[model samples]
Target: MGLIDSHAHLTFPELHGQLEAILERSDEAGVNQIITIGVNLSDARTAIDLAERYPQTIRAAVGFHPHEADSVTPADLHAMAELWNDPTIVALGEMGLDYHYDFGDRSKQRSIFARQLAEAAGRPQPLVIHCREALDDVIPLLLEHGFEGRRVVFHCFTGSPQEAAKIAQHGWRISFTGIVTFPKSTELQAIAREYPSDQLMIETDAPYLSPVPVRNRRPNEPAHVHHIARFLADLRGLPYDDLVEETAKNTRDFFGL
Candidate 1:
């Protein structure tokens, strides 16, 4: 079975300028599908456009990332909500808390996240969360908004086992990126090793974290997701093909692909 880079930002400048080459490489690497995520309203529109252009291989997820929280407006949210009408818009986020950079006001990030959650309250689309050093607040906010038992995923998870367990307890998912392959990410590898297979998925989060052997390469692309799959297969003691099938299935199930 082919692998799926469940999370990526294909519309980002780093990758957008050379999408044809990227898709060619991804094909050669066995990454048959990619879900391009949007960090803001404009980016989300671009993501939808990319998905529309490459219907078979790309899908889009829309939301205001925590880093852009400070710049969001009520009208922006309304326009984003209108995007759901697009058949290509598969999910509603990359949204959540990020205390690490504090690029956006923490209060605004939380408020915007809450507002988006409220907007998504009963929608059928699953959530694609972008939590960084803010799981405590993230989990509570998700629950506060009645997300328990809902379809949600914490993308590029770098949390501790306890945090992973807490997310699992809520029937949510945790997706891994190339970061898990870093030598210093031993604890993260451990979390991946034991995380529920059904709730597990993989991504490149591309134009960003490139897996080892290619980690030195800047502006990582979906093609590098193959390296991540191989690394995780070894880390979890499973055959490479098996890990690919499992993660691909999980990604498809989660994103309704």
Candidate 2:
């Protein structure tokens, strides 16, 4: 079975400029499916366009990232809501709190996050979360908005074991990126080794976090997702093919891919 890069930013300038080569390389690396994420309104449109251009292999997830929360006007939220009408849009968000950088005002971030969560309340689409040093706020906010279980996934997770456990307890999923393969990520690696297989998923988070061997490389692409899958398999002590099939199945099931 082909592998899937559950989360990526194919519309980002670093990867968007070489789309053809990227897809070719991804195919060669057994990464046949990808969900390109949008962190803003403009890229969200581009993401849907890319998905439409490559309907058989790519899909889109749209939202306003925490950093962009500072400038989000009511019109922007309205426009984002309208994007869900597109058949290619599979999920809502890369949205959430980001206390680490504080790129957006904390108050605004929470407000936008809550608003998006409210929008997502009864929608069939799942949510792709972008949380960093703010799980305390993130988890509660998600709950307040009535989201739980398999409907949410913390993408590029780099939280403490306790945080991960909390997410698991809520029945939400967690996705790992190249960061887990780093030599210094002992805690994350340990968590990955024991995380529930059914809820575990892998991604390249392309245009960022290139895994181990290629850790030094810039502009990570979807093709590098295979490295993440292989590393996770080895860390979890499962056969590589088995890991690929399992994660691919989980991604398809979670995103309704």
Candidate 3:
């Protein structure tokens, strides 16, 4: 039952502390590949370095997350644009607006997101978006400039079934993280029901949002993505092996893995 964690923050401090052990456990859990998402300029170098050093174990996606909107500048965006040339960097994200945190100026978040999206336009690279209580603004941004060679996936999706359907209609995929396994996440489970099997994917969002069985831990890792796949497989009444294969293929095709 080979699998892939489409979104895992291996560069995060908590998980990065024990990356080798985590990788060993991920392999044991059958999670064959992991994508390390760079949420800000600070982590970009680490993400790229990891991907370059361990091409078979990791891939990268770099962008300015909404939380860091205030910290980023036009100069930061320019630097990120140059990173597009790195073969190990597959996506421009996890980037998008997030009203939930309100950690940065909302306007700043929107501006950064739009800039990043525009930079990603026409490129073959897929996007790893992180929309949070801001899909009303997020969806249209993605629609404004259509994706090209690769696809876009809403990582650790926390949207409603309606929002999921809306993105699905636009040819984007929605990924579930350990959060989907939360006992209280009935809505996430319901949203899961709305997407067609082929349009859904799973992730760990490691070092955060660890699924139910593993939620007690502060940080998560790729190995725990298996818990999400299992939970969804049972929730959807699909065979585990079939679900794993489909999601793995979905990850590869979306990221051009």
Question: By the lDDT metric, which is better: model 1 or model 3?
Answer: 1
Q: Model 2 compared with the native: what TM-score?
A: 0.98
Better of 2 and 3 by TM-score: 2
Candidate 2: regions farther than 4 A off: none
For candidate 3, lDDT tens digit of each residue in 4-117?
Answer: 988888998786569889989999999889999988776988999999988898999898889999989799999988887788998888899899988989999989999988
Query: Against the unseen true structure, what C-alpha lDDT does each candidate score?
Result: 0.91, 0.92, 0.84
Clashes of 2: 0
TM-score of each: 0.98, 0.98, 0.95
Candidate 1 lDDT (Cα, 0 to 1): 0.91
How well is each residue in 55-172 modelled by candidate 2, as lDDT tens digits? Answer: 9999999999999999999899989999977899999988999999999999999999998888888789999999999998999999888886648999999999999989988889
Clashes of each: 0, 0, 1
Clashing pairs in 1: none
Range of the 10 consecutive residues with the lowest summed lDDT in candidate 2: 142-151
lDDT of 3: 0.84
Deviation from native of the Cα of residue 38 in model 2, angstroms = 0.7
lDDT of 1 by residue, 162-218 (tens): 998898899898889999999999999999888777767999999999889899998
